[model samples]
Target: MIFRPIVPQELNAVLAQVRPDPSTAVSADTVRARLADGEYRHRWIWVAEPCPGRAPLAVAIWWGSPADAHPSNLDALFARSDPMWAFADLRRRTSSAPRPTTDPRSAVAAALLVAAHRVFAVDGLVPAPDYHLLLPSGWRDRPETAASVAWRRRAAEGAGLRLTAEQLRFERAADRPVPSLSNRLSFTPEPDDEIFVDLFRRCLSKSLDTTSTRKALRIGAEEHARDEIAFYRHGTRGRRSWWRIARTTAGQVVGFAIPSHNSVVPVVGYLGVLPEFRGRGFAAEILAEATRVLAAETRGGVIRAETNLSNHPVVAALELVGYRDRTRRLVFSAT
Candidate 1:
């Protein structure tokens, strides 16, 4: 039978039954805090009804928009759990279920995830969501790791989610000197959203994330550019003072950079160089100036950045400015 959204009275009981992992069990206090603080709501929590009135065998809870949740929320809730997640609308989400080591119980969890997608759709969210797996550094070519990945891949396939792209996250401490701010490209502050989208079109490339997401959303280049700019209009977590467009001395657009932050840390929102201006090594200066602006604002905190694995040139530019690759993520979308 399908699950129902849990009510506040059942919050503790349902949370108690959710065992996401044997190693990282989420505490009731933590779940209560997140819920009471409004990180999630009754609708975002689902429970399987194996029968009419008996306790649920599995549960799925989603942390909705405001973009992110505390990273440890899931693992601690389930004690060594590796929850599958997605970006259904404006935020990242995951569902808690019994580990799929056994048959009927696993099926129940997968079904619940499918159901949650339908729930998210009511809010105009895309059917696809991202399942995040944070890998340890240097986790390549290991037989056991490969086996684990294969198992997850099969399970996701069964649920109609496809593995699309691999991403690399780069980070640096703010104390790192941003390569000297540019003298060639003038900085334009507070440009209209239309202007930013137009400039982004000049920088869009064949990115794995961009490609898969475009197909999933079935949007054209211009629409996707607008979405991209909207994701980083600056001031999501910090001030709008950090947004800038790089233009030539004559005020022609050359590139752009957005330095923003999430709930956790300062981030390089978007760094792009126009196609006609590529290979001139202009992105370094653009990014450096953005970083310099944010670093000053953040007072020497860590700065975060990410790019698709297939987008090598952008990756190279980030490295040139001293961004260290830290984590690798695989994005899965429900087909």
Candidate 2:
């Protein structure tokens, strides 16, 4: 099979293969919309075909910030239900033994990713972009969710993207009563970005958040902190002024809260307390502040947020602030 990215001429044909699925956030319409916004590009969408101009047997779509030079996530993957037949046919024609596999489509998907990464790596991107699987809460016990995730999980691992983190997604209506913040702490916006970066650096020292911890390991804590700040500044629709650094009434630093928005809706983007301030009930305080900020802008809409499943304190804080569990996100990466 030949594996390569589709061209502009093949957009319609390639798009036809991006079918809708209840388990996934990706769809043909979503792909088209992101493509128009430059978040998805032709060069980042790869396909596997039996020959030139033939219909693709599999497709892999990647997503990134519009201002980014390389894609960050493998948004969706699609493959024919019975790809082994095609492989068997090709093997027979070449007088070779066919590889054995009960799940052929996953193999095809893995090969497609491996081939695509060679090109992407040459362009200075990482070996593999992360793959996000958004599943319903308690997905492990759901048959359909488990079945749908099985093949993709195999494909991701085969392509060198191993399961990295699992996080709980959450949402709360703006109309929900805002949790009260602690009077012992005060929130204020700092004009200089460096101060927030330093705060993030301090927060990362013993953070339980998987993504932040992984990034810190990969690129030092300070750099990771700066990268996060840059993401909020350029990659999201959130305003910088909305960020608040929390401090005690006596002016000792406690933590910070970032009430932000993605392309869609307001989010409790980020909140963290320093190691020294841990277990002081400051986490819930900052979370409440972030929720309050977001609720004001959403105007009776919903605010979304997420935290690592292993982060008990943050999870407790989220629950205390009235953000209900919405879904779970399983993230895979080559790291």
Candidate 3:
């Protein structure tokens, strides 16, 4: 088997072999766009084949750069072994760059590290110690796999990687009726000017330590404040909806949740309650209201969210609102 550069004509053939689910597969147009985008690096399309007269059996696609290269990692790992040798033969022609010496243990590790680095770099950071390989549903159970748990453990340990435990442990409490805070706080779908300003302020306060915001501006929380407001208002730009809910009696902006159908799953992109409103069940009430709205619209899909794992209160609120722990990702500092 030989790895070689892929061309536009081979897109469907490779897609057929890789068999990615419809939701995740990039369309032909998207593929062409990425190819045209000068920013993307190390994009590769490869095919694995057996001895002479044997057709190719598998296809691999990888992308990203050398300041954070990963497709190289996969090639290095696969090059070391037998049928895997054929896997290495399939490579896409990419601009030349110096390669890392460390051997990656699995294609999954290569793919994950590439993705992790991209996310971190986009936020102007590097991969963190707590980073773990996020395996999609069926990868773990495959047979004929050279990638083993022991190999993964060794590779991660060598690279100083730390992983979160697979199980999501939570303290269970007796079932009690959700407190009737909905009546105490009226749920308004639309936010007037004053309410929008208050919501923006609350989001700015909550996101002071966010990976993206912290990297870009040291003291520009106010700027980010406006950006958040604009993000909901004009940035969404006729594509998604935004709303704010405030406590009527105090007239304080208790909490805000943005439920958008922008991805494969409906996402509650932002949610927060002011510091003074903390511990008053206001966050839960806001989430419950959002969930009610989503349910009414028959939004029966996973809702994804991420926060600093150290933020126990926010994690607790998510659990209370029916979000199961999915995976923990580490955000590393970019030097």
Top lDDT hit: 2
TM-score-superior candidate, 2 or 3: 2
Candidates arranged by lDDT, highest first: 2, 1, 3
Model 2, 92-206: lDDT tens digits are: 5533222444577777787788888878898988757899888899888988778788888888887889756899999998888886755989989898989989999999987
Per-residue lDDT tens digits for candidate 1, residues 211-232, read: 4345535676788787667656
The TM-score between candidate 3 and the true structure equals 0.52
* Alpha carbon deviation, residue 43, candidate 2 (Å): 1.2
Clashes of 2: 0
Question: Model 2 — which ten-residue stretch has the worst lDDT?
Answer: 92-101
TM-score of each: 0.75, 0.94, 0.52
Q: How far is candidate 2 from the true structure (C-alpha RMSD, Å)?
A: 2.5
lDDT of 2 at 161: 91
Q: Which candidate model has the greater lDDT, 1 or 3?
A: 1
Per-residue alpha-carbon lDDT of model 3 for 75-132, expressed as tens digits? 1112122334432432222122112223322332333334333444466543332323
